[model samples]
Target: MTEKDIILTSEGREELEKELSNLINVIRPQVIEELVEARAQGDLSENADYDAARNRQAEVEARIKEIETMLSKAKIIEDSNNLNKEIKVGTTVTFQNLKTKKEMTVKIVGVIEADPFESKISNESPLAKAMLGKSTNDTCEVRELKEPYKILIKDIK
Candidate 1:
């Protein structure tokens, strides 16, 4: 499938930019210094420090590349500053299970900022897809492996 446009809010974008800056300015320099020190130790075949430093450099560069790519294709979404009574990105939504009486609070956010463990779901998730455009008091069903459950949108902020 084609990659969906990665959405990000201003704060999220700033976070990514800050991370990129840190990786480039601080981490990269530290890794380079470590590599220099490791190389000074001489034995190429048995240099664990050199190997580890090189590996870390590779990982850091890879992350820089990924971040650059994301920033290049970034499609920043407006935060909920002026949003009315609609469910949109940057909005904290609370839903309660109709049958099981379970409650979940999810913040719909850009794909990059999605952290399910933190209750931040991407707009592309099945639950977010069903919740979009839905208003308070509306019920939606989430189909999982075991059973389908219904959730009522209790509030949005």
Candidate 2:
């Protein structure tokens, strides 16, 4: 079976790489040391420290494997300077709510890099989907809302 590609922004890929490095270079060694110290305590059957260390080791190893798999399937989304005035992934867009007249700016990114708190939205989101391929001054309908709101694209960068 073929593995599906995992989309990620450059920053997202860097974060994952940092995490993987920490797990391999720091956490893995720390867990190993903990296991050694726990084993030296003796009394194999009733050793709580040894049991806890083993559990922690399992968790760390599992996370390492998961991150490795994700990295292996990762497809980084590169920022483009020439998008032909169209809204797409890696584009920071400014839009004004037609009804409320409120303007907001958000960066469209892959799912892995989507953080609403950071004003980064996933391309798969309803608002982003409606805005994708649209040029500045175009109106888009947000279908996710109960009453679909219309937004006018003000700027793209």
Best by lDDT: 2
lDDT of 1 at 125: 83
Q: Using alpha carbons, what is the TM-score of model 1?
A: 0.90
lDDT of 2 by residue, 96-141 (tens): 9999999999999887789999999998899999999999999989
Alpha carbon lDDT of each predicted model: 0.88, 0.90
lDDT of 1 by residue, 1-157 (tens): 1366678877789999999999999999999999999999999699999999999999999999999888888889877553456788878899998897988899999888999898899887888888888888998887766888889999998
Clashing pairs in model 1, backbone N/Cα/C closer than 3 A: none
Candidate 2 residue pairs that clash: none
Which residue segments of model 2 deviate by more than 4 Å?
Answer: none
